[model samples]
Target: MRGVEHSIQLVPDYRVHHQAPYRLSILEATELKRHLEELLRLGFIKPSNSPWGAPVLFARKADGTLRLCIDYRGLNRYTVKNSYPMPRADELFDRLEDNRFFTKINLRSGYHQIRVATEDQPKTAFRSRFGHYEFTVMPFGLTNAPATFQTTMNNIFRDILEEYILVYLDDILVYSRTLEDHIRHLRDVLQRLRKHDFYAKLSKCRFAQRKVNFLEHHVSDQGLHMDDAKISAIAECPVPTSAKQLRSFLGLTSYYTNFIQGYARYSYVLTSTLLRKNPPWFWTPLCEDAFRALKKAVTCAPVLRLPDFDCPFIVTTDASDFAVGAVLSQGKGVYQFTNKYGANVDGYSPIYTPDEWSATGDTYAAGTQGLLLWAVTLGALLLGGALLIFNTSALS
Candidate 1:
């Protein structure tokens, strides 16, 4: 107990809300609050003061306990924008084609390690009753912190930038197939960080491994997978009761829209009904068809390979009463959804005679089909143009 007490004393009980006498009511919340109070009393935890009277951000002490933190959202609004180059998701995934191993590393207390430039340190001020305390290290909720940190890291690893690497704030990923290759990559990463005086907490980092989760995607020898958590979220979706609910469902599916073929047509009917004010919720045969079509699309989704700029693109497109969509798919198996949009289609049937086809229907169908075809042709031409540009420059 004495040793435990001494360890607690070393952990600072900083003020909360930028002031001393940090008060927390253990009585009102009872269960959870009591847990916090007990930890504080045992010296296992302390208050974390924020510079700008915002909420404090808490970190797990060497001892397992919760600490109070202030919110710093207010001060971060005024920071300068960070002009860092962020990696595109598809671009990052493309590099993993040959690799069967993956590893994810997260920095422990990432922002806390870096000192905010002394002049800018004063800007992170927060008000509290006891007194104001400023952040000795970079505080959370800063607008520019992410970009700044990312840029700093990029510079540190610039020498080996061509290798497989992705950095998002404190998270760094290294990918390779062989154990030996991964070890070499990890060594290079660590050595560069050392050269730049950037330290990482090993406890929070996972070194080269067969599979890892990054940005919620499960990456492994099998390739990238939709996160189970995301699947669960989709599963929890309530059945559509109105056009609004249906639209929300469509939006969710659209987040993984690339995985599905003809996604726009699949979601067309449901999306159409939602655009009108006070629209009645009608799950007609068309709506049911669209809904089932979307679900089926996911189940049969193709495994697309990565795109190579040198390869030719096989562009495809389709249209429906309400929407037009196109995919810029490459033969190597990789594809990207270049365009999708809702059309102001009134209604149209091409099979109908000139007299039978209503003005509204023809206009809608024509616009939808025209747009879809146009998108595909344009996408193909763009890819060809890009190839030409690159080759011409290379030769020159």
Candidate 2:
């Protein structure tokens, strides 16, 4: 089948050599052979005698099938990164505000639908026990593959982007304010994809629906909500026994930092454990308190409402001896932020002095009332006057 032509660009004076084939188990060997046979039959790849080769790796899919993948990490190091911009998740979510009807399309093996430029195909060659093969079509795990696919999608749907269509990599979201309009939008997107010979997996596609999960957030006419699965994972996480485990827990919770009020304060004790050097891992009473507080907070996270640009915002802040926190609200929805607990410099006594609180409150109040509260800077008096920056819109 005809596919979109994509080229891989390398930095000047960078060259890669062949990597020896990785040892595979008997099952892996059988899987690799099956994959090679299928790809050969489909003409997606062919026998190659290229100077550059990479070892193959197998990733198990949800269906218990192994996916053949080439380890391109070494090759990627020599490649120049494509600077093509991708649409921001926030901006994409914002476009679905008033959208009632939605359709999500998942392109089938999206990267494989694009052909590697002739001269660059050799650089993508990989070795297997059977022989060496190079991809005629673009393969997964390539550095520039995402940029190439995004560029193709953008070009294909240039006229409808941000209107009735939102394309992010291989996921295509077709949204409209009305059912009739939504159908038309979906038709237009499918027709465009057909024209370019791009195919979407029907099973994975969600037809006109009132609600859909996109970019890890549940989006609908009601507004954006944190995914329940993610929240459940956080709530069910066990107490960390080691610093590494604590770091992993922190990383997971930090993802929903915007959803949690005083996230920094809640995580302060656990974070401090990570900062300590040459010490045994110990879960203190403070750490235990923080962990439980975080779990409770995530389970009760507020459902955020879509921002209304027409309305004025309300900004509120509170400071304590341990930490400083702030909340930005519009309508009934609010986003919160806070500083670390016991964050002091030179062993300072107070975290935030009364005068500092007043000054900070005045700044926030003035900025919000004037609709110029683009950014807020809170000084940590204890940490030798370290500044904590918060973007007003980020909370929303």
Candidate 3:
């Protein structure tokens, strides 16, 4: 454990909430007993005598085993929120574009590696059929656990972070341009982990890989591509019979909103149906088209290319009856990230209709917005409106 520990800062007027443990079946009870014994043996948890009591339950793991989870919702309600920022996916990917070798390390029981502050241990108490117990180390389900863990990881890897290494909570990714450099970089990272008394799960770590998946993204020298396994739901998703199902589908696709151009325009029908006061839940023709189009577009999203500062960029744009769209491209193919990505969906002032968009004076303002968004990221941007004037010698 590091010298720094996770501390819970609860609201002053917080009320103490206690919960009873839910009954489990024979298999779950056996799993819980085994877990409790193991945790006790490792000095992670111990029998407690405290007024603050949360209940524990079992969630089935992918390997068909029960994972003991504590219902800390009551306790989380009164805890002060942590706002530590995690690394941006776009920025992280931008750094890996030039690297050839990659190593990803998965910390073993990341949260449990951090010790909870001594005075805050009782606050982590949870109830069980066997007895009341509390965590000595940081436990999952705490409101601020992610932020706390992120802060610790950031501090540990701050010097090398974004240079050739990146950490998001427990996942560590190290990137290098050459095999020789990768070895040196990997050694440095391992040494730091060793000095800090951290451990990695060998089964989960990938060393000197040409490509690896980190934070739901596939990375390599070529460009960015969405993981096929992660997006399988988009292909197999069924028509929604209820609002909940529709919401679930949208939530799933929302993560890759940046990958698809004019996503809001394409998915507007379903969103409007969900958000607006509506009649009975019915699958309209437009809703079906929107759902199918989104699934296809997201699944076939063009591989995002690394920015080429050596050449000029093209910003292709179009205006529809309801939305105005823009695409940032370089050379022949689009090569860019989304940190400065600008897509105006339901954003253009409705003063000009689709027919007047080209002829009207208001087109200047809308066009400038697109140019500025792309320009802010790259020093040079070509606002390719409806025309292109290039040297004829190149085409010949």
lDDT of each: 0.53, 0.72, 0.73
Give the poorly placed runs of model 2, Cα more than 4 Å off.
1-3, 25-27, 59-67, 242-244, 275-280, 318-326, 332-396
- Candidate 2 accuracy as lDDT: 0.72
Judge candidate 1 at residue 289 and give its lDDT. Answer: 74
C-alpha lDDT of candidate 1 relative to the true structure: 0.53
User: What RMSD, rounded to one decimal, does every model reach?
Assistant: 11.7, 8.8, 7.7
Give a tens-digit lDDT track for model 1, residues 84-143. Answer: 667666556656656765667787666655666554454555433434445545655666
TM-score of candidate 3 on Cα atoms, chains taken together: 0.81
- Clashing residue pairs, backbone N/CA/C < 3 A, model 2: 344-382, 345-382
| Clashing pairs counted in every model | 18, 2, 0
lDDT for each residue of candidate 3 in 10-42, tens digit (9 for 90 to 100): 999999889988888888888888999999999
Measured with C-alpha atoms, the lDDT of residue 84 in candidate 3 is: 83
TM-score-wise, the better of 1 and 3 is: 3
Ranking by TM-score: 3, 2, 1
Give model 2 RMSD, 1 decimal: 8.8
